[model samples]
Target: MENKKEKKQSKGRRKIEINKISKKSSLNVTFSKRRQGLFNKAGEFCVLSGAEMAIITISPGGKTFTFGHPSADAILNRHLTGNSTSGESSTNLVKGFWWDEQSIESLDLEELNQYVESMEVLRKLVALKVDEMEKGSDQSPSDFLAMDSNSLLDAFASSEAENIE
Candidate 1:
């Protein structure tokens, strides 16, 4: 009697070259897999750090893919308006400006106009604050530091009232 042993096939991960994949089908498959992995990592980060995140990706075929802790549109609007629903610090607010210039260029004319208007309003508010400082207002830097959004708005409103009076 002859004994024959069957060898099992190993199904383990293999290292692949970092070069661009030439085959369309292979490239599509890789993109699909890697995109899911990237989204998963974003979700894990949100869960672990109690932070909110939104990801937007365009596939090679021009299809849009998005993942957000809340919703993509909501997260985007909040970032654009510089409103912090999560009480994040100013550093995180700066980080929200991570959108590429190409994305901004792709916005429609109406949206672009709105962005410009919002920036103008912000600029005017900053100028008002600077004027107040130059006029030697009683409100100190520490007072501004302790002010929340509503209080800051109130401060501005009171300043406007004083100017009117």
Candidate 2:
């Protein structure tokens, strides 16, 4: 006969029931952690799939927290104005860096203006990248890689700062 001893251990993972937490403190803690986890996953999704997302959540206490890939404003505005164009109709819309000439006629004046501004921003960024490449120092991996939303936003911010000064 063989005797087996049950090892004492806490449950590794448990399925959380779909129910509201009765305790305010526990709910708050769970909300905070889960919110962060959700935002982290959203960011990862955006980076991996070249997708954009915006999550606006109001806590039980009424405080609002936002997680936006690229930007909440851009995503929300695109949704509101129905400016989201995809597929072969638009060129590089995913990167927001370029658009096809054929698609230019489809845009309103505001959209055309916005596209022009985006192109200007991209031009400035390219100039900066060229300068960096010329310098051949402190070359970031992003310099040679495809521009993700974060890097693109950073480039925009830097360009805006340069313009301001």
Candidate 3:
């Protein structure tokens, strides 16, 4: 009798479509890995050039992460002060900035915007659940609960905002 062993074939890397990933679990996994890779590259660049670097990423799951070589705050502050040059002194232009003025890159502002969007989605879901409870919706509680966060959000995004409010 002869014994034969077959080797498992592995598919090498291939190009992927750049469209939005629809699967929630897969999307989250890909987002996290890519974000980590980006941060790692930035760190490498900083180490090689002795340059300051910062990266901020917002995930679809409402997670916020930051990477900095030196520190993210120091890099951001230098940029804001218009003194990114190696030998220049930075003036405090932010001192006189008004509250109404906006800096989208501000982590607080970015985080706040993300929080608001998440809350809006939650509110819509709650309103829908209440309405369905009263009307005896075709969708069962189990079915609704089984949906991933992204699916739940997508379903209610087009709902009547006034009614929900």
Question: On residues 25-130, what C-alpha lDDT tens digit does candidate 3 reach at each position?
Answer: 9998798679869988998998899877778788796756777666566677778888757332122233334433655566596577765665676786788787
Angstrom error at residue 88, model 3: 9.9
The C-alpha stretches of model 3 lying farther than 4 A from their native spots are 1-14, 86-165
TM-scores of all models?
A: 0.41, 0.47, 0.43
The true-versus-predicted C-alpha distance at residue 135 of model 3, in Å, is 41
**1 against 2, candidate with superior lDDT:** 2
Query: Which one wins on lDDT?
Result: 2
**lDDT of all the models against the reference?**
0.70, 0.73, 0.68
lDDT of 1 by residue, 1-165 (tens): 659777898978999768988898898778778988998999899889877778877767666677776546567878999887654443454556544434777889988876675556557777877788789996555334333557656755665566458
Tens-place lDDT per residue, model 2, 71-114, is 66667777887887534222334556444435888989987886
Candidate that scores best on TM-score: 2
Q: Compute the lDDT for candidate 3.
A: 0.68
Candidate 3 weakest lDDT stretch, 10 residues: 87-96
Better of 1 and 2 by TM-score: 2
TM-score of model number 2 = 0.47
Model 1 off-target regions past 4 Å?
1-17, 87-165
